[model samples]
Target: MDIAEVLTLADDLIFAKTGKHLDYVQDAILRGTLEDATYTQIAQELYSSPSHVRNVGSDLWKTLSKGLKKNITKNNFRAVLENSKIYNYQSAIVGENVTVGENVTVNHNFNVCPEKARSPKTPQNPEPTAKQPRIDLGDAPEISTFFDRKSELTTLENWILSRTRLITILGLSGIGKTALTLELIPQIQHEFDCIIWRSLRDAPPLASLQTDIIKFLSQQQETNPPNSPLSRGGEEIQPASPRRGEEIQPLSPPLSKGGLGGVIHHLRSQRCLIILDDVQTIFSSQQLAGNYKPGYENYGAFFKQIAESCHNSCIILISWEKPREIAALESHQKNCQTLQLNGLGESAREIFTEKGLSESEKWSELIDLYQGNPLWLNTVAAAIQDLFSGKVSEFLSYDSLVLGDLEYLLNKHFQRLSDSEKQVMSWLANQNKPVEISKKPALLELSPSEFLKAVESLRRRLLIEKVQKGDRTLFAVQRAIAEYLNS
Candidate 1:
């Protein structure tokens, strides 16, 4: 029999014995074993960690061994299933009764012990009528003392509830993009059937991410396909498609037309909230802002499709810099929006209050100097308490801003700037106040187009701000950024 047939039969037999169907990961592991693929290979194809795949494989083998009443392992699973075809036929004939060993008998009636079904049970309560949504916040940083952002949270909720398919949270690092999303989860988790949180820090390939998400959404179905292994006994099984590497390939005509139809299908069928954190990791660091790294260009298409396509799901992309696709798609599409997160403003004073610093007039200037970034304020507040005996005025009397731990933080963001961006930033640093674009000095030796491009790049990178100056637009870097540039 073919591999699909074998997988179908295995699913039925395992369900018959264990009163549970194989999950997508378990099914993939079984198929991989039949195809002579290793855990690493399967994990790569599935966009899952290898250790997670191996754990699922181990549990599947153990369940099958108990169900078949024989030692079933990855090495011998195929042979064992092929040998049991006749027994499977006989078991179907017996109806609710099956012979396990020489004298052992097993019952297949699912209703007799309803509790033994595959569904999980609550500790003190009976089985829930509906499955609880799966929540996976992988490596998301915990926020202990989350200050303000109430209005932002409400805006996010309104967007998600309005069926907005794609939302991008744009901000500088340590500007609370992740914190805002974490805060939003509790308010919106009930709205989605499944809520997943994944970071693009390692920049997994787009295909792998699509496969992983599709698998998770597909597994929410209540029943398996009818053309299962046991039902297709002597039929031909088509070979699995060749694995795609990390490089981008031209999509087949069908896939190109569909634009990830499988993933969209699941999104249409289910309400899922997928939060992709650290999305800036996928962009090329040395290039202009919003440019994708090699082999990652497909991500732009993926995001565009998600934003434009009709689906019940919502995707929240949290990034240090906004992607170019977001700017294009969000402008024309009502269902897509971008939330640019600034610092905490007056609410940030709470950090100083919590740090036991005595409040004074200087507190406002200090907050302004750091742009109200909680991480930066916390570091500065600690410095003030330690070096100035918890006196804010004493610390502010110095001629310059304290660059203590803030230097390390600012250096990280500054190091990623393109040459043009650095030059523009340095020019802005020397300005006494916000300057209009038309009034920029000609000493920089840039044309109007080049100057505007650099300014736009800086805006995307969250390194500069644009403001209205009567009639012309004025741009200036934040105090912290200006300090970094001047230093």
Candidate 2:
């Protein structure tokens, strides 16, 4: 497998089993030339201390070994690599011809031509290799790392099993959207005859993207147009090797239909699932100023087509923020499902306990404080282990437990709010129960209209819950976010 594909698979494996994110050091190690470098060399290259590199390498081996269901070492890392077929190939296109897979071979033999014989040309230089920084992957969570996200997993499974052509998961930043999506890959991968995930993080050129899609799907290179110019910016475009091919056609125009109508034809005929995660960056509205920092233009229409037309295959969109414009397209024919995820449940206790924390005297209070936000729990748990010499139960009683990362975990979400908005939210959080905005507008120093608007925005973001009593509407922050603020 190519380095990119291997790194992607390794990352997915590490993150899926373990709820921990890969540190930058780990990412660098995975992408670096691992064959020749020693731990000390890696440390020097990453500008980190040697001990840190050693630790990262040790941890990475453990994680990979666990994921592969066997022991992993530098000697066996290559063996583990051979056993996996997760991302062996991709998709591509040529003129009107489209293909899927990689490593396509062209059988071409040429005799010396008169034109070639007539001219003497200087030899061209080979492209220079980039000098990549060294890093250690051992510092990241082991592959066996796991979070308690049963509810979110179940929700994703339900949506996948639902007869919906399109399902969208919406939430704010760091809300576990990526984690949740990665977690689901293993569970649902077996259900479909084929499963493909494409990251729209860097929205490439449309033609280039289409080429990649076709290559991954068709498994062969489509014949290019005759005498087509292969050089762009003075660089020659090399032909790609071919793999397996499944014939398909693009869906009919109005193109909101799955952009891969042609591709889905093959998948539907064979039964498959396609996950397009973080597609929000692609579908985000370009009209909004500073909205999506450019390069992503008019992708909403593309997604609308995928949802409306693709039925034989499932297209899942995992995104931080929902495209509000999609609400209009909700119709009988289109099965567009939206799921908003929250924090972990009681199961998180198991996660913490497994991490070596003892039963807490104030179990409920501690859990309530962290609200079982998976990342926060791990961060707090690690901090507790590193700092506290006392038992977990005793540590719970001290303010130090609350003062560490747990406090920031709770406050991070609140800190995202504007000063005026946070003041309003803080007041609501401190309330014994829900209070009508009108009853507390003076407390926040906002006019009635402005207070109402702020409340609505928070509610839409799922930071707060709203209730209606007679003619008045009361707003309260969700118990989780509130606990953070009140903590």
Best by lDDT: 1
CA lDDT, candidate 1, residue 409: 89
C-alpha TM-scores of all predictions: 0.66, 0.51
lDDT of 2 by residue, 1-487 (tens): 4764556556545554553434445654564434456666655544455666566667777887766667877666665566543333321111112231233321111011222332234222232222121111221222445566787788778766554667777665445666676677677653343455666666655445544454444431233222212222233334222223522222122222234455544443333456666554553331221134355444565556656653445667676445554555555443677777766667667656766765655445656666566676677677667766324666666643355554555564454455556777788878888886655456678777766656655654466767888988777765646656766
lDDT of 1 by residue, 90-180 (tens): 2221233322232223343211123233224212222212223566786587888788999999999989866788999998888888988
Error at 343, model 1, angstroms: 1.0
**Which 10-residue window of candidate 2 scores lowest in summed lDDT?**
106-115
TM-score of 2: 0.51
lDDT of 1 at 485: 71
In candidate 2, how many Å is residue 307 off? 1.8
Residue 227 error, candidate 2, Å = 33
Predictions in order: lDDT: 0.72, 0.53
Model 1 residue 230 lDDT score? 16
